[model samples]
Target: MTRESEALSLRVRRVLHAPRAVVFRALIDPDELARWWGPEGFTIPGVERDLRPGGSFRITMRPPDGEAFHLVGEYRLVEPPERLSYTFRWEEPDPEDRETVVDLALRDLPGVGCELHLEQGSFATPSRLALHEEGWSQSLDKLDRLLTAEGRA
Candidate 1:
């Protein structure tokens, strides 16, 4: 199914076969994150998340290229089982490498499904936005598979 949300930002829509609360918890819980946080080939080494406004997150990962990268961000908004917004950046101290805002929202559907819609905005340039869009799409595809498996077991 197509998940569409137009809100002046980059968007991604995925229909998950789980309740909104369950899916939202996976987004907020660090333990659940390590299971499926990145793309198919990446692995998370550390995950620290505080799921409230003014709270932050730190995650470290190793790519297939054997290089380690870190994502550190602060939660800007949190509306439980509904919406989450945050500021994202690479772990580097350099200001030029920091990314913009990422917003994740969950909408409960009529039946036993939930639609996850993500918005990534405030990119420094078009090239950066494009790369983020592709990367997030791939990551969410992995997340879809992961959540589906989790729901089964």
Candidate 2:
């Protein structure tokens, strides 16, 4: 089997309604991330970020039905308004699941807009990959709304 088929990765790009710095903070800062860090209808009751290489973060994502889930990761590389890369893994992981890398690149497009490129994973199953894609998409949507409301658009 091809390498991709063996361990697939998901990639997506989106333009946000904010400047690069704003978008960058939304991804790194605990409060900013809590504002727009999960799927629709999800709330974050707990968030911690150490914000440096080798530093770790943990976020509690509580869904509408309660039973919060935790997302934990460590910073691999962090560059303001430019690039950030980290290792991501759910707190309660699947038996076959492995830690995955998430790389984000932000490009400042003039007129107070930024482009975000997100690449994540090498999942053992398609369902796992799909789950992340859907979650990330929704989170990005919220981020866009948050930034727009901040008048940064």
Candidate 3:
């Protein structure tokens, strides 16, 4: 088994028109993931999800430059529509470091919308944190578009 590692995380607020359950389902459901899985222009060619603990959730992200980054990780915690904490490690990380933890949470806002929060911690340096901040921010924007397109918002 791979060792537990650290990552720098961020907390974000996303108001989706759908209920917390619906938003959470979109995140955990593999079939629904393809629609909004990458940062802005990047594409997701493959995705595999396991909804239970110890299951593997893997995705292949294809950037516009044709670079493919395979994100392979295991599910550490899973509570539908409420919380999900996972171990996110790149398949081909820099030889020096190879792992990080990403924790995601969902909260219902009583007829308003769902709040999606994320915490990605344990990064070794501030640069890595900054890099991920950009990536996740872009990805969240894409998710907004996807949810809107799906008529969930």
Candidate 4:
């Protein structure tokens, strides 16, 4: 994995040990997403998605110990097995929270697997960026493990 950061944005790259199609499906399939969508110890109790441009999704996240919260988003672009872009915002935002855009690109690596590039941006502050960085880091780690356990690795 590799990461690049700016004051209000972040980029994360990961090489998943799975085919591009497999990884891409996991991203858009609500059932697959619920299996590995959050940071360590976080569980997704509910996931609702309409997978298409202009479609929206809402996910309920239950932390290790706390009331569940929600994050909602609307799809801006959805290109299967390649790209997806969406607007992301917390249902109940912090003082520094603001809606942001998330873009994902999946590239196939012949004879190997796939590479995922994730970019999210225009945060209200560096601290918010850091928080998302950590979350994505852990979430991606979970994704890797899931693919591996499923024998896609």
Q: Evaluated with TM-score, which candidate comes out highest?
A: 4
Which runs of model 2 end up more than 4 angstroms from their true locations?
5-7
lDDT of 3 by residue, 1-153 (tens): 223333344456677667788788878887677777777788888898876899998899998898888999999999987998888888888653447777888888887778888887667666777777888888777777777777775
Report the number of backbone clashes for model 2. 0
Q: Which is the leading candidate under lDDT?
A: 4
TM-score comparison, 2 vs 3, better candidate? 2
Q: What total of clashing residue pairs does each candidate reach?
A: 0, 0, 10, 0
What TM-score fits each model? 0.84, 0.93, 0.87, 0.95
lDDT of 4 by residue, 24-80 (tens): 999989889999988999999999999999999999999999999999999999999
Tens digits of per-residue lDDT, candidate 2, 74-144, equal 99999997999999998999886778989999998898599999988888788889889999999999999
Itemize residue pairs with steric clashes in candidate 1: none
TM-score of 1: 0.84
Please report, as a residue range, the 10-residue window in candidate 3 with the lowest summed lDDT: 1-10
The sequence of per-residue lDDT tens digits that candidate 1 reaches over residues 1-153 is 123223324767888777888788778888777777776688888899887899999999888788888999999999988898889888764443446788888988867578999878665555566767777777777776777777731
* Deviating ranges (above 4 Å) for candidate 3: 1-7, 95-97
TM-score of 2: 0.93
* Model 4 quality (TM-score): 0.95
Each prediction's RMSD to truth: 4.8, 1.8, 3.7, 3.4
Model 4 ranges off by over 4 Å: 1-6
